[model samples]
Target: MKFKAQLHNNTVLYRIAQSLAKLGKTAVVQLSQEFIKFIYLGESEASFQLFAPIYMKNIFVDYNIQSAHDNTIYMEFQVDNLIKVLKSAQGNETIAVRLLRKQKKPYLTFKISGYSRSGRTVLIVQDIPVRVLTPVQMSHIREPVVPQAQVNILLPPINNLRSVAERIKSVGQCITISASNTGKIKFHVASEIVDIEVFYRDLINPILPNTKEFESDQIYQNHLERYFSCTISTKNFVKFLYAHYIVPASISCVLIENHAIIFTVYVTTTAIGAHFEDQGNACGALTYYIPAFAL
Candidate 1:
């Protein structure tokens, strides 16, 4: 079995590895003709999945997979080790990765080549045993009922969010996020002695799908302008904010009452000189699901 690919954007690869490392040490990577995916889980049973569609031009110079019978290749590797190697990338370098099976052992070789006069570096990492996880059926999970009270608001830049979270994290074990239909979102934390609320106003509220369903519900309609709040662990929430180093084009917050608060990060590779204006241009999405804390 042989698999190789040339990655056009080293920064994107580095960022993805770094983000995954923050969630878990190991991840299952799937390489096929259609897309490349990295899957892992975090706290609160939250799962993080990264997808790089093969259809994107300039993303992958060459993706070849040759196996005995199957066209897909599944492998497991330490995310932190990969991130350490990828950290050496100077943002403009191209990454080449090749997988080989030697003596019944899998090895991954990474080559980082700089664009300027800087020389190239090659590193070979021997992969541990691959453990394939059984795929979970989405239909098995209970879908949050429609007309559920949810507030969709655009998040501030990642750096800003992280900085704010760092300050308020120490004050409370969990952070409360509250949103109102009047175009306002608040990050609040309250202790026995003190209370803190950071308000972000004048932000655009994304149009939720099936608005008519929510409108017909009297409970949600009456409190439509009232604040809807959800609490999530401070530690886990801070970790999710660290993905800002990847410089996602946009991050949106969706708070579902009695459900989960989901952050959808649209990842685009700036190393390729491509500006992602909308979801259509995004190479992948890094979504963080933080289950709501019981009130």
Candidate 2:
């Protein structure tokens, strides 16, 4: 079995590793002919699973995969170790990865080459013991329903969000995100000593699939105009906010009352606009889900 590939964008590859490392110490990487997937599950039940998929043709300049026994290859490694090697790569460097078996053990060799110098690092494959909750089981476990109140809002600049979140996170255990169809959103944190609310107005509210249905119903229409609030762990939400630096494209937030809020960062190698439906080929995405809490 032999697998080798070369990626053109070292920054994007490093960002992918950084996103996975934010969730857990280890990451499960599954490579196929079409795409590469990185999966990471947090240590806590309330923590969300980080799923990043990068299309082969979109990210890689040269690729080859040949398995003697299987069509797909799966391996696990320390995210920090992989990240350490990836950090050594300069912005202009090309990343080369090779998977080979030695003495019945699998190993991954990573090489970073630039115009002047190059470095190589080899890591032994390790097994990830963590088991992530599947989407089916997650729905069952959470008993999530179609949110009575939902908001699809365009996110503000990542640096602004990160700065506010960092300040507010120190004051509260959780942050409350409130949104309305009036194009207003608020991030609030309240504790025994201080209460702070950061407001952003005139934001675009993207039309969701059920927007028409909600518009026709008087009850849903009324609910849409009213502020819908969801609380999530401040620490976890801050981690999600930090991923903005890794994603060069636009980011969007979808909030579902008493259910889950998802932060999706559009990733693509092409110049095409960001669309939620785009997947694989020239486009891929990374999504971070934060479960809502009722207090």
Candidate 3:
């Protein structure tokens, strides 16, 4: 197997690592010719899953992956370690990722090149050990599949939502979110003595894309007057906000009534100095979905 990618936007990759670091400790990196996926599946008490995939053209200028396992490779590593090394980069640095093996053990290495303050060139190499997944192990992992969402409302700025969620966390263990085709989203928290609410009105309700998962009959065209709501743990909601540490190109709220809440983050992947890539057809790059029952 061979894997390598030249980083076109180092900040995007670093923020991804940071987002994953807050949700779970380990993730499966799926490397294919078309995409690089950072996936986290629920086990034990996790009750949540993260699916983040970058379009090959957006981040990797020079990308290659070859494997006998149908041209894809899967590896598991510690998210904290990945974030620690990535934090060493100072925004001006250039970073590249590759795979290597030693003594039958695999490692994912980052090669960072930068200039020092003293007018000197410096290259930093950081290697984190990883567990390569066999074909059998890979077959058992799958992304979560959900039915069509009842409401998909374009969200207010994530930072504003995060700030509200954090403050509401003190009033209750769970936060209730209500959204509708009315172009409004309201978050409510209730305690014995206090009931607090934050509302974002007049926001746009983006046109839902036509996909197999959402058939023509399943769209929310008739529900413009109704509100779909779900309650999830405030702690988990706050953690999900970490994904927006960097401003998103687009972020939307998706609710399946009493079932789940899915936050789709379309990262701002405009390559520095380049025009904004048309992401109209691209699926949400990062999906953070939490089941209501899990909390």
Candidate 4:
């Protein structure tokens, strides 16, 4: 998202209207008020005020604005070609000098009509400050944070076992062991394997502990041990899942007002024949609740 800052022109216009309404029958106010009627194409009188430095007194007295719509006011004035001089003034300073110098800028006009003890009053107008959009800017955004931990698991020999090994190599850590009855196959990834290593070394675990490939005694569980660690960065981890067929699960919840929840959990597809009542299978979601030990 982006942000833009500009003057609340509508509020400034309202102030101008209020100032004119206080002018009563003053000739200067009356003339500006009269000019406003023609510009606004309406008959309405409103009070307005214009405050500026003493040096700018004449500017406010002679300057005028007309309403273009329910929320817009405009002015017309001329300025020298020096944009630097024009950009220095802020808010009132900008409007004051622009009007007094008759800089080539826009003006505001308002429609006004009223009747006082003296007689009819019309075109009550005043000049107010405003701003416009100039340039666009861009900024960088920070990514989200992710907590991490380590887990060791026995992997199954899927079709893309080699691909999985390569992924683990990128992380620089991981250990996988595939056991079967026909023979025993052990695997260990000492470090993350990158594309360059494919030329010097095999991507797959060429040796498992003592076995070169598959051994019948080691297939079921002949004590084939391997150690590997993976340093998973958040970005790479997310990309890995994106490349693989394995999609993470998702859960969504909506809650209103106060609510409470206790333990909750999930069991993976490869989980041993476990019961849902086990602590490892329970997790919790709550709208609001205090911890049991908080007291």
Best by lDDT: 3
Using alpha carbons, what is the TM-score of model 4?
0.15
Highest TM-score against the true fold, candidate = 3
Tell me the lDDT of model 3 at 132: 89
Q: Which wins on TM-score, candidate 1 or candidate 4?
A: 1
Residue-wise C-alpha lDDT for candidate 2, range 102-209, written one tens digit per residue: 556666766655554345533222221223223344332331234543788777777788889878878988888998876788999999889999999988787543
Count of clashes in candidate 2: 0
lDDT for each of the candidates? 0.66, 0.68, 0.76, 0.24
Model 2, runs deviating above 4 Å:
44-46, 66-70, 91-95, 112-149, 208-221, 247-249, 270-282
Which lDDT tens digits does candidate 4 get at residues 1-295?
Answer: 1111122222222222322223222211111322221011101221111111111121233443333232222232211211222222223211322222116533322222334457644333343322221212101111112222111122232324446555554544323332222222333334333322211111222123334444665552444332222222222222222211211121111111111111111212222111223424322110111111111
Clashing pairs in 1: none
Instruction: Record all residue pairs in model 3 with backbone atoms less than 3 Å apart, i.e. clashing.
Output: none
The residue pairs in collision within model 2 are none
Q: How far is candidate 4 from the true structure (C-alpha RMSD, Å)?
A: 28.8
Provide the lowest-lDDT 10-residue window in model 3. Answer: 270-279
lDDT tens digits by residue: candidate 1, 38-114: 66654324433333332333356787876654566667788877776666644645667788655766777766655
Task: Report how far residue 92 has shifted in candidate 1, in Å.
Answer: 8.4
Per-candidate TM equals: 0.78, 0.78, 0.84, 0.15
Stretches > 4 Å off in candidate 4: 1-102, 135-295
Q: Report the C-alpha lDDT of model 3 over 106-144, residue by residue, as the tens digit.
A: 888888888988969889998999998988987766665
